[model samples]
Target: MRLGLVLSEAGSGLRRNFSMVVSIVLVTFVSLTFVGVAALMQLQIGQMKGFWYDKAQVAVYLCNDAVQNSNCPSAATTDEIAAVKTALSSAPVKTFVKSFRFEDHQLAYTNFKKQFKGNPVADYVTPDILNEAFWVNLNDPNQSAVISEAISGMPGVDAVTDQRRLLDQIFAVLNTASITAATIAALMLVAAALLISTTIRLSAFSRRREIGIMRLVGASNRFIQTPFILEGVLASLIGSVLAAAATIGIVQFFIQGYLQTAQRDINFVTISEAIVVVPILIGAGVVLAAVSANVAISRYLRV
Candidate 1:
């Protein structure tokens, strides 16, 4: 009987302030949408870090015939190549270096051209003119500096380049983006909370006389307060649910459909992953509403 009365009062309150309920729903929707986007952005950053970090490699370029040096002999000598290979295979760094090898200029140019098929640079670059480079796969990409330091002055080696540093810079940018999104979401959520509180206060204000009469009769504090609190909670929760649905729809229709098409390699988390955030959002909204309603009723209850 208590539950039914509370529910009926909640329904009556929402029905009377229907416009305010709509506004609350819109605000909650907007806030939770940002929260969902922020969650997906963080997920993407993690995915990118894993994908790029695992595939990172160090490229070691060798001297060519045009370069005049005894170690290179204007070109990589048989003994020079052999010595470099032997050093790589049996050096102190061997355990860390998964494998290292030489690639002819022609093969290097072929792969490079394939990547830039119609570009102007592709027109000028050919395998015969390019310098040969040795590609090194490491057991750990983060140890690029150590690997480079070991091979820098070795015979037949002209330069040691580690691509991992470039990836680190990119990862830093992703981290910054994630932080910025989180900050924005935090501010918006606060704004939503305030709006919800104000809306609930106004709704409570309209029923003040009815509440006074209830107290004048024989109503207990809990009996009067429970219904109002439940109304606020219901409004907030319904708003959050609407927001979650809209967020999922927008992501599925726009991000996965368009942005992903343009950048095929990037796989953003799906709506299912983003949906995990809904329960928290709804809970927060409900709690905020209930607390706000309780505070507004406290003054009337005391008087």
Candidate 2:
């Protein structure tokens, strides 16, 4: 019976303050959408790090007769190549380099042809012009500097290039974007809280006479407060649902559909991954509205 009464009052309150409720809903929707995007951005960054970090290699470029570089005073001889192999096997550098493979001109040429197949640039390249190099795979891509430092001054080596450095710059940009979205989301949430607080206060003020009569009739404080709290909670919940739906659509239609296809080499976040954020949005909405409603109602509930 009391549940039904509370539900009745809550519904009436919503109808009376419908416009403010709508405002709360829109603000919550936009705020939680930012939260969801922030989550998705974090997931994407992690996935990219996992995928690229595993594949990143530190190339130890060796000298070639066709190329003249300071690191290679003369063309790399068979003995110099042997010396490099021996140095790679030494204890100090072995732990830094997870595994290293030497690619001769023939294999390098084959890879080049496969990479630039049917391109006009491929016609000018010959097997002898390609540098023979040791490709080093590291256990941690962040430790590329260790391997590079150890191998850079070695005989017959031209340069040590870590591909992961370029990836780091890209990820730095993504991190900045995620942080910016979260900051904006926080500001919007503050606005939603204030709006909800004002709405609840107005509803309590307009219904003061009814509340006073109930109090005189021996209504409990919980009973008097339940309806007002529910009003705020319901609005926030509806906003959360809308936000979840919109966030998923953005992830599927725009991110996965367009961006993923355009950058097929990257592994994009799936709909399931984006959906994981829904519960968080719902929880944030419920908590925000409930707290705001109670805070706003305290001063107005005279009894």
Candidate 3:
């Protein structure tokens, strides 16, 4: 009986301030949607990083006739190559290198031909011009720097390139995008909270006479505030549902339907991942609205 009466009062308040209720709903919807997108973007970035980092290798390229650095005035001799191999097999550097394979000029040339097959550039390239390289796989990708520092500027080495460097640049762009979405979501959430507070204040203002009557009848503050808080919770709940639906649609259509097919190499966030975000959005919306409403109503009742 008590619950029914409180719900009835809440419904009446919602009806009295229909426009404000709608504003809260819309604001909550957009804010939660951004929250969901930012979460999924972060998940996607993590997945990409894990997938790429595992495959990344450090390529230590040796000097050849076509390339001349101050450290390598001429092509690397057989003894210079032997010394590089010994250095890789020796202390400090060897600890980081899980395994190393030397790719000779012939193998490099073959790989280049296969990569640029049927291209005019392939016709002009020769095996002798290609640099020999030690492709080093690391037990931990983060240790690539250790290997590079040890091998770079050596007698026969031209450059020590860690594939992770390129991957870092790509992930940096993705991190920036995720942060932008999160910032927008935070601003929208603040707007939603303010809207909820305003709506509750308006509802309380319209029912000041009723509130005075309840007060005179010895009704508790809890009883007076319950209906108003329920009004905010219900409105925000509706918005959260819409945001969840929108989040699901994005994972289904945009990520799975388009991005997966378009970029087959990349792994995207799935529906299951977005489903995890739905409850979080709903909980956040409900809590924010409830708190905002409670504070707003408490201030109004005190006056």
lDDT against the true structure, per candidate, is 0.76, 0.90, 0.93
Off by over 4 Å in 3: 77-79, 90-95, 104-131
TM-score between model 3 and native = 0.87
Per-residue lDDT of 105-221 in model 3, one digit per residue for the tens? 999999999889899989999999999999989999988888888888888889999999999999999999999999999999999999999989989999999999999999999
lDDT of 1 by residue, 123-182 (tens): 976566666877888898878887788778887787788887888898888888878877
CA RMSD (A), model 3: 3.0
User: Positional deviation of 281 in candidate 3, in angstroms?
Assistant: 0.7
lDDT of 2: 0.90
Which residue pairs overlap in candidate 2's backbone? none
Off by over 4 Å in 2: 63-79, 90-96, 103-132, 140-146
Model 2: weakest 10-residue lDDT segment is 294-303
TM-score on alpha carbons, each prediction = 0.84, 0.84, 0.87
Lowest lDDT block of 10, candidate 3: 63-72
